[model samples]
Target: MRPVPLVLPLAGLPHRVPGDTDAVVVGGGVAGISAAVVLAERGVRVTMVEAADTLGGRLGAWPHTLPDGTRQIVEHGFHAFFRQYYTWRAILRRADPALGFLRPVVGYPVISRRWPDEDLTGLPAAPPLSLLALFVRSPSLGLRDITGADRSLALELLGYHRERSTPALDAMPAGKFLDRFGITERARSMLFEAFARSFFCDPDALSAAELVAMFHFYFLGNPEGLGFDAPDTDYLSCIWTPLADHLTRHGGRIRAGAAADTVEPADDHRWRVRVAGGAQVTARHLVLALDPAGLRGLAERSPGLRRVGPALAERAAGLRVAPPFAVSRLWLDRDVAPGRATFSAVTGEPTLDSVTCYHRLEEPSRRWAATTGGSVLELHSYACVEPDAAQATARMRDELAALWPETRDAVVRHQLCRYEATAPSFPPGAAGARPTVQTDARGVRVAGDFVELPWCAGLMERSAMSGILAANEVLAEEGAAAEPVHGVPQRGLLAGWTPMTRRRR
Candidate 1:
């Protein structure tokens, strides 16, 4: 089956491409590329401008090769998606078949320095079973309370609705969500901790709504794919490189190092986009695919846009993304033990949120898992804990020492990558709160994971989906055949929860 129809309208754009071209998408990440590709496929001449030399903003710098020459195809930070990541899965399936998908027998891993009292070896059949297994095997749960109240709590969460009179949103702290659900401290530390660390934010700092939505999307949905796995190529090769190549192949121009300095509206709503070190490129319609905050300085130069700029700025500012985090790489002298990509390791203060032995997942011959000699071992640390560069770097080194003290001597090489404000907290209302792809003003559009697949929509898939929606809407208004399928206005399964589904334009 095809992906669910997801098209966010980039309506209200004035058609004036000068030539036959339809739109100009700014920012060369997944969003820009997706929009551009979709538009090109639908017979629109599209120009995509990227500020950086490469595409795939956060996704570009990942899948690092190790010292032993073994590659651990890890994300900059640990990020994996569920089966319901329809946009992501569809892209990968089109790109390569070898990146196979797998379903984990367990939900989140329960790890400790010592083996637990109950060994959860047998995989459960479904989510409820898996949750039951987790509660039974986990160390932190209070048996009586969990057995009594937790089931109801889980149901409530899985079936949460904004109109359901649940006061979960008012409880800002994610910790409260766990507490209210009677999740044992062990479950909190093991399962919730890893998920929160995936955000790279503090549990206390995260909104309960965001946490709840994420939990349901990632863990409870699909019965298998949430924490399940399918082999997948790195995000760059599958999404960014292909897009850049596509743009280049189509005679579309992309200038690297050309940061947008200002956006000014011409006499008839045409956009003049001035670049940092290049000539101004004019287009009929312009897309500010950038996170709103990134455009603050540029908006200052244009008249009649100053007022609109700050409001956009507020959307950007108010959007609380996961704080910056450090991705640490370690090159090992010897091969790592073989195993499945793991989210295990229940610890007191979890250093690494989740560990994936990329070598194991992507390569069997590499002879290492998370650790690689001629290989690479990747570790993701919480950004909130280590916000600054110095602290992040030092802490990663310290983490290396702590995890494998003996490996310190055999370390062949190391590298550190830090991504700031990497992903937004995609709670439920956040999607509704997402700024429209079309703004109130003229000659402007927005496209990002934040705009389309707002709930936990960080990966290239969401970006692509958003871009496609934006481009499709723009082209449709220009009298082009709109290939994108919009979401059915009528409610179907689970449509009761989505506000967007209830309303029709």
Candidate 2:
């Protein structure tokens, strides 16, 4: 089942001898780990520092014990790995040649409680056909609904060009854009809103450009269909642990529980990073792969970062963090109906956005369910309106009970709720303000999902892409060829013409 390891073909640059170049990567998330791995593969000495005791920042997991002493690594929420994630898949393939850890979820199902049978499934994979099929088959949409939409904007959906179309779109809010199109309220609630919430932003608050770009990235530009894959087991074991192993095997040092306090240029022109516990790491290059909040914190607290300039600090401070998101996991004393989907997006719920029956989707959960004759379900809420976790969890539990009557009587054996303010906001006109991987500061680079990238991607893919770009910047400075980065194309036939191009005719 294992595939051969694909080697990077860097032209004109011989792999440097090990330990010749040194890099200090701040943060041990996917981006930091990815940067470290690429550098180490090129024979550079990499030192990765993580604030938490374990790797995988927002993606990290912790062990939880069941009543019977069985332990499992519980994560913050469900993470969907789309097939379009080429860069992330490449990194994973290096660690797991077989790519056996991923399990595909058949279709993108959006479920509604008001009409239980109205869930979206089995739509055609290819576009134009996919759009046609969805409109025809969906209970919430109809030919009449399409007729009501803005003729030009509706036609533009099938052929959005990132470069030509997004600049104008970026100036407007998604809600206003949809209003111009006169898109049906049902279509807005069922599809557009769901997608917007996925990014943890309100539809009215998000930029139309971001929505169009994401549509192209997830649908039009994607070679792989809309279906996504999840880990066969917990991410800690299948993902982060394997990546950590790969980094170490490639001569990189991973220092967990090491909180970097300052990163300043030393007299020798090497970057000197000091950790909270007085540990110091000096390297020729420094990659600040921290999250949005982390970056802002470093800019405020680290005097070394101030040396980069007032502009870097100002930019960090200006970056926006999305509203808080929440996740709840419940161990029910009964199984859901066999007909229930493994994963489903929910509508008509105030706080709940999606639900996943882990016992049905994951093998370990299935085995545990078999023994207990019960199920484990994880529910997620993005940009939750609830003021606190207790209220959020209560509302979600009630919604679950109403959706699946079996859960009303089933006893709750164990439950966990988590809330965090981490997602990057993509508000109107925000794209132009996002930071790039390469900075003006010497020996310094930044990597995160929020950073601006040349190609179109979001979430974990964006994180990995930024990391690779940061590493490539350093590689380029050393006169070595940069690594290849992949992206899904966004320019379609109808989208090829911009307002300027059309006006020229």
Candidate 3:
């Protein structure tokens, strides 16, 4: 269950590059920050440009004035900091060496209206045992469901082969895969579908191969248990500001609020990132670490970029953005039931997928609640069908009231709703067409969750791993040693067991 070394340090290699090894990273998300941190620490002159005024992109947090004139930090969305995010935690260590800001979420529950809640916490980390534990303890699943299920599909789920499984199941939808796997409807709704919708994609629109990969990465092959932790404060204070200071401490320059307009070529340097204000950052290496839509737009804007990095531009063009998701943070005039879980993954609702009682989770939110005798609640719809923010917010609120019951009478003093299409989508038959860390482009690498990686990682970890891999590429070109990367167990537990079973028979 130990992490496998995907990238290892080499002998007879220098730790740092020459003093003038310069790089410019576009986008200030995990991907860009990771690349900038690694390069800057290794003596590269790193310049990071972010469109937003803050460092974290999707994970960004900013100050907001409540109706009572209370200043509070509002987050863009909620994210679970899983224990298995090796590279991301390494990068986070630059900000807080001890990572004291994180607090463990006690239980992982998928709550539904039709059946009772299914808790995914305390499951064994390794597969076979974990799989057996789920089958044994889960109220939604039973021995009858196992006996009635498709054995082949069940075996395939157990044996997730990166090289073969993806091509085999890439053409099928996740919904169809679950149906074929013969899991009961109760299990499908409370457990499988709840997990599927977290990618901001409907099960019918998501790829089955992607679903299997996620199952392996998050639950089956993970050495870390199902429990995860979250920041007790805000990202701006605990994560971004400190990490930004860490970057500048090592001679890295950050140009916040500077949007990269065009990526133009330079005769003296490898690339120049031209910002909105006519300021340009020229560097020997470039990491285009933007969201799918942002990267595609930049590629389209800079037609000449096709000449230097045709593959990067083409991959950007083909990358798909997931459906719009919504986050609605409500300042409730009353607190929910005291015994409610701090965070819960919700299912069986058309518009609501998850809800977090921020007052119970974070320090500032707790302070606000304690002073005002109110609660800070955040509702999310990962694959929201509604486009309008207000309408989506209303729907999620109504759904929350239906589930929680106590929220039916609570009045919302203030609410902030946001709907955007920022996450990547993995559609059926869309593998191998996406770009990886090392593009065919000269002196250029792309780092994002949308970009295909060779290893198994979920959302934030995927971004960080890609960023580190991109930095390693730059380090290789500069003749400096590459950073080591770790990954969860690559193959599934039952991968080679089929052959053994046949041989024994």
Candidate 4:
């Protein structure tokens, strides 16, 4: 089946020559790379500039030497590859046609300190049945809990009515929606709240519409089940380096460590982007595949961007960033029990939200574990309230000990902690205000997870999808066929039984 068409309306862009140096794509994240790759494949000369020395942006990793003289590549955190991420998979397939670098995670495991040994597995793969199995088998939930839920909200969640339900869900907070539907406090905390917080947004602050959309995307609408996959190695070797090679092979230029300081319109009608250290390049089209903060910084510093007028400035100014999040990785001198899960969702912990046994899941770490008989664990905290890295790390360690007592005695051989502000917040009523791929400024497009995508995907998938849409926007202006973007169907059974079915009968 063909992918869904994006609803990007670029009415007034002027056609331009698709020649060498035709486009300058800023920010070398997934979005930037995706855009650059598409442009280069279409025989458009594209120059990609990245502030960091690497091309992965948030997905970038840096090498760190352990005290024992071993080196490892430290990353921001773990990333899950859901099956519905068609565009991202397609992009990866361009480099590695076989997609041999990914490893599947067999089951979804949600754990709590209150019951560390509990087996929260065996939920059926298919939905309605899966939902039923979960409710039936869960130790925390009961029949009364399901019966007490508000019928209308439950129906809206299970019954697919995109036109009528999307706006209604968008108007309320996810926490409020759960409370209104009478979802039990324990059930909410264990499942819904944990899932919401995993995305770095508190349930009370995030949009109910976004939560519902994710439910459909990851659980209900999914064809490959709720299980996810992850890269078998560091993102640098597996994803970024390969993509960079692919882009260059397709005739695209990449400039690492070249930070674009400002982007302004030149006298010749082309956009002049000035990099740090006095380097400058002019291109016919510019794609700002930057994060919200980066975009704001560009607009604030560049007189050219400001001169584009109030509409673009207002949209950029209105963008909201979520609170800071933190990731901590520990190298222990002892191994976790072999039977313990490789990855798990954590609740009832003060600072730790999830944990991954990298030694079990990643090939490099697995080989290291075999040699040293040790373990490598990564802990994550979303929307962290800690004031400093030390405090966050301390809390995470203590919580980790609480959940897995073995960690308390495991000697730390090496450790790394990172705290930074990341991802855009999806607050109640924030959907309509989010920017799209096309901006009011001519020849300028934006791509990021925060941008309003036509499809219901978020995080890394959203970033890649937005990149595809951004490139297509420029292609449409050049009178080229827009690239197809894929999205999973949201309406399951309802999709098969349309009004036309009744009319035909």
Candidate 5:
């Protein structure tokens, strides 16, 4: 089905007509695209340069197929879309109208050996009110168990919202918070191994403040109608189409495989970029939308950027990209009994993390089955160990054999692909320490998910927003009237409060 079209509200500012001005945009990820799109719309001639052959850096690598070439069983990496992602959904709707956004029939199930086998069945049909409601209401835990630390269960979950005001929560590990709540040993094990592996991959290692911030981002303010699930469409085709189409229609240029090797600040506050192919391009404005690590190559070109170099280097240093979390999607060789929109077999078995049937959606059962062919069963399990491609293959085969009794013989063709860095790790106040968009140099500016505000939760929407901000900074320097992009407006980042302004409606 085609996705619906949408009209994104451009942050309106005074329109200043430039005299044949050109801006160079670095990186081709969501952040870069977002900034490029906004600038193009503002009549800025943007030449977006990407080092990779593709636009999406890490994001493009995701939603890929396995050896046997199966389809994605879950939502896109980067970030799972919900109703709250107005900007993201607007782009998808504009791209194609038939893209159906369907919430999973079950709430995200937290599986553990201590829970009952059937406990993960279709999560209770409670309207998502808050993170606490979503968690406290799940069949996995009892109120008494969660509220044992405090007299009031409501206070226990939501009341501590203010504890983050102090530095202790930022310094505390998630284990400390869980212990204070008196969470069961089984629950803790399950959260760290099974549930977290599905996203964070190392919940125990993640900071309590970052976790609390995530809780706040999802459930704090926008408490109504917050259900979590996968989108019912192709990942890139849904969001990228509209943004790309808009840029193309506006005479904006996007050239891939043109990795920018160096960017030198030229006279008159303009910049010159030397790409890998010996191609040289000069622009009055420049946007550095590449990641902090990726831009390390440019340190020699822009000397003024040296001050922010350490901050950028520090972010790159701490990055432990989640080694693709183990998830195997099995396509049954033959048809089997089909029912419901999504059927998950969460038997609470440590090895058998979860099973999903692709034929459950309203799409033609025969056609959908044809997509997977030979019947389909998608299996998801936590990474038992660090994944080495060949070793993971062998280990997946062994795990499949142990979990699916019928799969030992009946299975014909199956594919395995790990969800690489499904979610990025942001320690407490890490978002606050994000590098400045504007460097000490007059011309160069930064944009990307790794920047302060949006990518904290590591979602596509955040990166998109960051891109818009990055572009705005460069455009503004050229005396062009662009809206200021909003970064997370809070104190305690590095030291003083630095505002991250991105285009907003």
Candidate 6:
């Protein structure tokens, strides 16, 4: 399960691009910044224009003052930096070579009101063994559950091959696929259902192929196992600022608050991007790295893009945004009982999905807690059904209290609630509709988590991979060496093997 280097640095190539080579990356999240870093280091004059006032996109954080005049940096939500994310880790190395900001989070446990917490961390690192350990140790899934379930269907989870699995399960809903497995309700809810919501959609609306792919990517095929880490400080100080400094040191410029309004084909083999304030940037290479809806809007505005990259234009039109997600960070007057995991994935809840005791995870939160004798807790709902932020926050707080009784009486010192529909939705039959890093347009490329990728990756890793791939395409066009990209074992251990089919005898 160790990493396999898919793209290696080539020999006999110059380290930097020739003069006059420039790239305009249109989004400044992980994807856009990733591309910018690679391109800038290669002597490509890179200009990254981000729509928001701050970088990081969905992972972005900014300054906020609590009611007591205590300053804090808040984020869109919590993210787990899995060790298997080699590509993302490589990119992060540019900022902090040792990646010192990240600290290991102990014990990833899935909590529920119906059953005791099911720990998913520290299993064997490789599949078959890893899968076996989970089967042997997890109380939620046991012998009776397996015997009563469809054995052949359950085996498919271990034998995930992109060629076979994507074709076989892409058209089915994840909920339907899970139901067909015939596992016990406890196993389904605690293990599978809880994991599915992390993708920002209900299992019923997500593609079964995605569920299987994720199973392989995060658990079965992953060599690094399930353990993950988080930053010891806020993203602004640790991630964004350092990254921004790194990019600038290589002659790159990041223009925050410069939202792109329209993209038009320009003269002399260049693309012209019109910003909100009537300013425009024209560059020879254009990386359209934006959210699903942002890409669609820009594509719709650029009528001439159809002539250059009809497929990209069409795919942008078809791209679907996932349901709205809500994150509520509260400054509680008191802490929860001892031994609560830093992060807990909750299942079988109406609106709540996960909770993070920020005070236990980050340094800034810990300092705030020490100064005020209060804790900082964050609740997240990937696919929130609530109508607004306030309602969602209230519901999540109530759900958390139900799970941890001590939280019921804790006073909310200050709370920040955020709601947005920005994550991509992988609905059934959405396999290839997304655009890839290299588009039909001569010098235009796309990079985002939503962008289609040949190898298996998810979340932040996917964004980093697409961005690196996009930069590689630009490097290829410029006759420069491509940056190396590593990948996990593409197929599961039992990829070529199939269990007995329940079809005809």
Off by over 4 Å in 6: 499-505
Error of 1 at 486 (Å): 9.2
The lDDT for every candidate, in the order shown, is 0.54, 0.79, 0.90, 0.78, 0.52, 0.91
TM-score winner, 1 or 5: 1
Q: What TM-score goes with each of the models?
A: 0.77, 0.93, 0.98, 0.91, 0.73, 0.98
The full ranking of all candidates by TM-score, starting with the best, is 6, 3, 2, 4, 1, 5
Model 6 superposed RMSD (Cα): 1.6
lDDT of 1 by residue, 1-505 (tens): 1233544434554333223655677787667766666666555666777776666666553455654475544444435555455555544444444434333334345444433422333435345555556567556554754653455445645554433312436345776667766765655665676566565567766667656555554444333333445334455555556656766666566766677877776665577787887578887777777644454444555554545444554454455565666666554455444443244432444355434444444443234533334444565666446656656655655654554455355554555556366565554344455556766656577777666342333344456666766775667667654434332111112424433223321
Model 3, which residues run further than 4 Å from truth?
A: 497-505
Residue-level error in angstroms, candidate 4, position 349: 1.8
Residue-by-residue lDDT tens digits, candidate 6, 1-505: 5799989879987777755699999999999999999999998999999999999998898998988998888887789999989998999998899999999999989999989999999999987899889989999889878777876667778888888778778999999998888989999998999999999999999999999999989989999989999999998888999999999999998899999998888999999989999999999999988999999999998887777899989999999999999999999999888899999999999899999999998878999999989899999999999999999999999999999999999999899999999999999999988888888998999999999898889889999999999999999889889999998899888776756322321
lDDT of 4 at 163: 51
lDDT value for model 6: 0.91
Candidate 5 weakest ten by summed lDDT = 496-505
- Expressed as tens digits, the lDDT of each residue in 106-183 for candidate 5 is 544443334633233332222233344546655445555555543232232333232333243566566566676565
lDDT of 2 by residue, 1-505 (tens): 1111222547777555423678999998888888888888887889999998888887887678987787878887888888778888888887698789898886667776765345554555567676777788876678777677776666556667666556767878888878887767777777777887888877788888888888767766566657788888888888888889988998999899999888777877788888997989999999998989888887778776676655676678788898988899888888988878888888767888888999877666777888899899998888888887878888888887788777778888888888888888889987757778877667888898888876678689899989988888788777666667776654643565444336545
The TM-score obtained by model 6 is 0.98
- After superposition, which runs of candidate 2 have C-alpha atoms over 4 Å from their true positions? 1-10, 15-19, 116-125, 498-505
Residue 285 of model 2 has an lDDT of 91
RMSD of each: 6.0, 3.1, 2.0, 4.3, 7.5, 1.6
The better candidate by TM-score, 3 or 5, is: 3
Q: CA shift at 475, candidate 5, in angstroms?
A: 4.9
